[model samples]
Target: MAQDKEFEIVREFEVDATPEEVWTAITEGTGGYLWPMQPPEPRVGGAAAFGSTVTAWDPPHHLTIRSEDVGFPTQSANQLEHTVEPRDGGRAWVRYVHSGIFTDDWDNQYDGASRHTDFYLHTLREYLVHFAPRPVAFATVDGPAASAVPEGLEPAARALGLTAETAVGERVTVRGPHGRPVEAVLDHRDAYFIGLRTDDALVRFFGRGHWGAPLGISVHDFAPDADAKENGAAWQEWLDGAYA
Candidate 1:
């Protein structure tokens, strides 16, 4: 039998800017200032000094750093990795993954990591949204209420309940098959939403909040409702034509 030794935390954010703009923030801009504890060198083999060693680096794309003082011998080789990818509509998405051991005081470490990750992400967003060529807005929703329906979704609203509200700062959660549920957020002004379902899959929906535009959605294992399914197809078609 295989042991569940993998412990990790992953986060993703969409930035209303090009990959280069977002890349600078993560490697050479405000992100460096905020996380002084672990400044990224942002080049292959470049060291990330801050009581830690950068194990790997790939400019404008990926960086991995390791911290020995992570508070647990078992996780002494703890590593954190960041990746950036460009998407449609002059936007980019960033993903951060931190993997390490569970300390005896796991709660404290978890809290600290969570806070730091959030701070870094928010700071990065602020920088990109403020300085990038295009405007950007960031929003996030948490808790069980995030997954609940608003009680009176119109036919259209019901069909596009979560997909329709892709405006910045909108969040929705809907009960999934079985006792599992789905939660999602529209980050920045990109026509996309980040979704998390009970199945633990990270999902992405493209062109969700484009008014008078078609919508695109993607999730693993679960299929969208009949109406939502059609809307997604149309949304993608519109984007292909409009952006192309």
Candidate 2:
């Protein structure tokens, strides 16, 4: 007989923002960073997105939410908890935990989710410190199927002038969709992920093919006139051109 296995990911970090600011960033769906969340009802036992329910809610301090038992044969019980505290020098310390159970393909699911948590939290800090108060237009696009191989991200990286030798904090200017110039700095880099930040936007690239999915890009455009749908389509065109 088969069995279910449990996994939990915990992360702690400091961000250069007050607890209230961090709280707004984490709980709002402003799309300034990471995935956008639907506004959850602000109380314990209230409804949340993704078939989850709010188990605990405390403003600027703590929160716990869990997924309902959806009866997916291979998985159940996804929970997330977050705690925030004020720190010296106008900063905040954050602790995050995500726990769940899986009945199959445990290793791949665990690795992907864990690494994604790190990247998402890093982006959260970036948003709180630099891009708060601006409404963001977010766009996410996946590369063509041809880009779904071991080196799935290399083409996009090369198009953006990134390489294996690229180091964090390195600055580069690349032409984005519609020949728009993106003057930015490399904020994060690793074997399977890349992040670029401009004065008005955060651009993230995921080499998901390393784990059996297509390479992808997400842009958080903070300009006052940004359009999410147009941005997504333009990036999709750019990606198609790159693979062509």
User: Least lDDT summed over 10 consecutive residues: which range in candidate 1?
Assistant: 138-147
Candidate that would win on lDDT: 2
Candidate 2 colliding pairs = none
TM-score to native of every candidate shown:
0.45, 0.94
Full-model lDDT for every candidate = 0.48, 0.86
Q: After superposition, which runs of candidate 2 have C-alpha atoms over 4 Å from their true positions?
A: 70-74
Model 1: per-residue Cα lDDT over 80-153, one tens digit each:
78788889998988898988765444554465566446644654565466443222122111112212222211
Q: How many pairs in model 2 have backbone atoms within 3 A of each other, for residues 3 or more apart or on separate chains, i.e. clashes?
A: 0
Off by over 4 Å in 1: 1-6, 31-43, 70-77, 132-244
1-244, model 2: which lDDT tens digit per residue? Answer: 5478999999999999998988788778448877688866799998887778988899989988889584667577788898999999988999999998977678877898899899888888888888996889999999988887778878888888667787899888877887777899899988788899998899999988877888899999999999999989999998888888
